[model samples]
Target: MEKLKPKLFSVMKNYSKEQFLKDVIAGVIVAIIALPLSIALAIASGVNPERGLYTAIIAGFIISFFGGSRVQIGGPTAAFVIIIYGIVAEFGIDGLIIATIMAGIMMVLLGLFRLGSLIKYIPYTITTGFTAGIAVGIFTGQIKDFMGIEMGAMPAEFVGKISAYSAHISSFNMTTLLIGILALTIMILWPKVNKTIPGSLIAIIATTLIVKFAALNVNTIGSMYGTLSAQFPTFAFPKTNFQMISKLIAPAFTIAILASIESLLSCVVSDGMIGSKHRSNIELVAQGLGNIFSGLFGGIPATGAIARTAANVKNGGRTPIAGMVHALTLLLILLLCMPLAALIPMPALAAILIVVAYNMSGWRECLSLVKKSPKSDLIVFFTTFLMTVFFDLVIAIEAGMVLAALLFMKRMAEVTNVEGWKYIDEDEEDSNDSDSISLKKVPKNTLVYEINGPMFFGAADKFMEIVSDISKDVVIIRMRSVPAMDVSALHSLWNVLRICQKHHIVLIFAHVNEHPMAMLQRSKFDVEVGLENFCPTIDAALERAATIKPYKK
Candidate 1:
């Protein structure tokens, strides 16, 4: 299991102080970066900016303290932007709290059950497509803030949101635009001068100073949303209705799935940087704890942030202390700088998101999929992206993934036809485990062909193509390698038998597995082909074919 899993306790206990110091430094830097991001994400998610800080502080701390990765920093991320916004708008913050808490519990349970390793089963294309889609949605949502448009009470639906954006286009404020661009520029240029400090913090502080000293009439967070309270979050309850829970279960599960995917992916990336593997199950449990705390503390959902994790790694974070330090840093800022934070420009936050959107959006990945990926993968990728942008993430992921799977199955089946008799030497696989099976030359008028892999609908065409290529007195198809058969495949086999009858060639199915034989028996195919013609093995089939080779049926 070392190839897939970890002994969670050992990894945690092996931590050293040297790593802790580095982690602390990295954590401090990440905290600075996460500061504006947390508030911005929370605001975008339809809650007060403080809730974002709460997630980064409370949830972030819990995740880092007990999480799987040494350097993973957890909090509200851009990926959950669309979902959290919808939940809050539909059922209010109370509903969001309950859902997050429930999902957390679910995650903990999943880890305890050791299902963490199984999460790798989720397709890569699904993650890539939806991530890109989210990037686009985040990009679009920030347009109002960046352009300083007054989109009052934006709708929850994508179509409605677009209409509202267009309607408010005339109200764009240039001062907000200037603040946003200035912040964006500083964010871009500051890091080159000092890698130790985060560009985002510098940008926020710089923009806040300009607005305050200049007495700009532009809407600040304080001007627009009122001042943030300097109080810590208290415990709260959304609701306990199982009926409501049932409805939210699917969403909660979606959150859990997303959390697993995102956290594990972050862990993988961090591993590349540090050359150390993470305890995935332990990390999952830690994430669960973070989510639970987030819900309890009036915070939004949280997960491992890839960008933040990468930043930590790059900044010399080598242990869990860095993640913990990062959390503490946010807490210190929230307590000390809450009121001062009110003066920050919303447009500046919007600019950060636009940059975030660009970074997160896999537009390049999407283009590559369209131009270079196979037809099935391309279909799955684009379909997932379209669904995510136009519809809810839950729906988009569910439908897009299902469609991709079906297409994959169809393709697999098409390549799995009967190919026993004609020429095994020419089409034989190289000296590998798969290509070990073969057949010698048969009688002049006899045919023998072997079938391979699972026989499903797609294999129907291949099955037909193989048999149609042969013209002999008798045809014997081998089915030794075929492990299972679908109904469509069985029917296709029967039809080929009928074709052999029309061609006046004796048709025989050899060495069909017991499972496939039962299916054929249920469909009464055995009666039509005759019991004697159905050989128990390829050797028996070859003997029967030789006997029937010289004469027409």
Candidate 2:
């Protein structure tokens, strides 16, 4: 069994001063990159700017300290913006907190059971589709601040938001639009000038200074969310009841699934960069604990931020110490520099999120898949994407998974076949093979049935149909091509056994594969059928059939 140990412990055994210095440099650089983006993500999530800092500080520290990946920077990420906004809008902040805590508990259970690898079963099409949809959601949500549109609180639904934006098209402020454009331009152009300093940070600083000195008439974080909190996060338990838990269950599960996917994906990406392996279950447990603490401290839901994690790696971070230092840096900023964060223009923050959305959209990948992937995959991708954009994200995920499963079952069923062997062709290349059914002579009043492919619920009904036609004095079932069995398929065989008993016919099984044989043994189907009736080959089964006397009805 694999041990549940954090990567930090292993890395610490070989820690050195030179590596510590590099980690510190990388950690501080990542913190600088996370600062403005965290604030932007929180505001986009319809929360105060400080909550982002709180999450980045509290959750970030916990995840790194206990995480399986050396440089996974966990905090408020763009992926959760749509879901978090929806939860906050419908269930209130308390509901969001409760849901996050519930999600945390669920994550811990998933890790403890060592089921983290199960997340890979979620189809890539679905993840790509929803990620693109989330990018769109983030872009749409920022339009109000990005263009300074005069509207009451933004609507939660995509259609409602579109309708409201259209209604308020005439109220967009020119000054705010120009500031947003300026910030966007800076974010786009600054990276070429200085790669070491993030373009988003530079854009924020430039736009905030411009807005402040020029006394521009535009919406700013300070104007909207009021003074930024300069205090450390304080913890408090949320008041909850059964009614709230029941109401929030679906969203909580959604949060857990999303967090698991994003964090593990980030881990996989970072592992490639660092040439290291990550313990997925350990990472999940750390993420759960991080979210639990973040929520208690009045922070929004958080997961691994891919961009920040990448930034850490590119900056020479090679251990968990860097991630921990990154969190501490954010804490120091939260305590001293938070007040300055309020002066940042809303348009600048929107500009930052716009860039984030574009990076995460994966448009090129989506287009390539559309051109080359199978029709079923394309259908799943489009369905998930459209549903996410127009309906609820939870609905999109549920519908996508269900659709994918049904399509998969259909394909499996199509491949599974059951047939009776009439006569083997003498001209066939392998007809003379020793194990060939052609060499065996069937006894009078005997029938041979061959089942091909896996025996699963999807293909069980066809096998049952073959069972219903069993009227021979002696029956032989050939399952050499079968590799596995499900309960439904096993139950169908039981029906065949019952029919043979009622008709007073001799029953035998030939070439029972390992998986099916084990299932038969476990179900005690083998005992009821008699061990002597089970044959290893067609020759043996034919001989056994010939020796057995047919029972009189």
Candidate 3:
């Protein structure tokens, strides 16, 4: 389909040798930066380290090869850590794969239906709330490794996790704590030292060497999860039934929604940086294919990683070739150096996730919203945040959306108003000298009621109450300001038309906007009220009213 055309094709048409070289260099640098992040995210997601690498190599390649954005690098990101962990914890790795595949299918359908732009309708407050909540969860989950606390399996719930950590406070390993703090310190300070090199990678290398040479008793990846697979990922299908499918549908939708939002948001950010527009539907399709392949290859869900995409852009990666090269570089590392990943210290990985949690929290934005946004918006924000922290993300999003819809309806109702035009005597005003003035006097036995704002269901009741109170031989409804109307509003108008007809009164409409006019015509309200009753202006309606004979009592 034309909608599925990848940006890579257009970029390659004008590709240059200099740009190619720059892309190659940037891609390699991004791959290096992504290496430690992928492994760390996988561990945080409660999966084997190799799964993350497989996602980077497989999904990363597929996305870049077919994605709409020029320099968006796709891979495992911090956003999915909470959802993936929950899936894996409840249903095991197989459930996670199946859910990811289902989410991929959903995404494909969304793209095919051209619903990419609709993702923007999701409220900013909800995203901010859930994102901050997830950050808190990730940070809390890392406490065990960060402090080297000796504890059994941590509880999945937020409060339970905190209680578990507190119970194990006496078992903290000072050596592990020192390593974590040191890794976190390096990450914070490394940007100032060299902007090009990633501090996470540096921390991994430095800490791993220190533990290996000194023979420290600290836990490493190998000690915890065993050595990672060096071979390429193989296709593996998951077994499922109707019951499992039904149970996974909600989580799958959650994943699909989240992937759509994150990838599109990344594309928007990339567009601003490169001064280019990205095809959102095409990107959604690419993300779907990427996740599908990633799941098939025993990997986790993947999307456009914002930080990595920014890295590509900042390093002069202006084409999809850079993203492709990034995937290839990661693939090479997976095939050649995956075994060495086992030597990476757990605390170092934990520290990296802590930094990730901190950056992803968006605390400044959250605080700003709390202080400046409207009370209704703050209610949605806090409700989503608390629900996400206490319950599941699915519940949090569902509740947030419902609350937002209700608040939106209330606000719309406040904006929509209906009032009858008051008769002003021509003699009371300093006489109008304008000969071009239309409708010199109000027509006798005629009432003009002005309807303002959109006539949706929320304001339909008020509209009906106002119009029902008008008693005249002819009623002219002025709707120039009404841009649109829903079915409820149309039904209310139909009721008014019937009441007017019952009383032998003529009903007319004046200056209706395009959308409302179309709706009225579609519903055949114009025919029921007589086509002649629809006027182009208030003056025209007044002229029509004067022609109509008075009703006989």
lDDT scores in order = 0.82, 0.91, 0.90
Over 1-553, each residue of candidate 3 has an lDDT whose tens digit, in order, gives 3466899998899899999999999999999999999999999999999999889988899899999999999999888888888999999999999999999999988888889989999999999999998898899889999889999987778899889987889999999999999999999999999999999999999999999999998999999987678998889999988888899999889889898999999999999999998989989999999999999999999999999999999999999999999999998998888889899899999999999999999999998999999999999999999998888788989999999999999999899998776566655554453411232455768877888899999988887754565467988888988988999999999888888878888888888899998898898888998999999988888889899888667
In terms of lDDT, model 3 sits at 0.90
1-553: candidate 2 lDDT, tens digit per residue? 5457889998899899999999999999999999998899998998888889889988899999999898899999988899999999988889999999999989988888999999999999999999999999999998999999999999988899999999999999999999999999998999889998999988999899999999999889999988888999788998989999998999899999999999999999999998999999999999999999999999988889898999999999999889899999999998888889889999999999999999989999999999999999999999999998998789999999999999999899999999886555556536456766676677767888888999999998888655565556888889999999899999999987898887887788999999999999999999999999999988889989888876665
The TM-score of predicted model 2 comes to: 0.96
- What is candidate 1's CA lDDT for residue 56? 92
The prediction achieving the highest lDDT against the true structure is 2
Candidate 2 local Cα displacement, residue 118, angstroms: 0.7
TM-score for each of the candidates: 0.83, 0.96, 0.96
lDDT of 2: 0.91
Question: How many pairs in model 1 have backbone atoms within 3 A of each other, for residues 3 or more apart or on separate chains, i.e. clashes?
Answer: 12
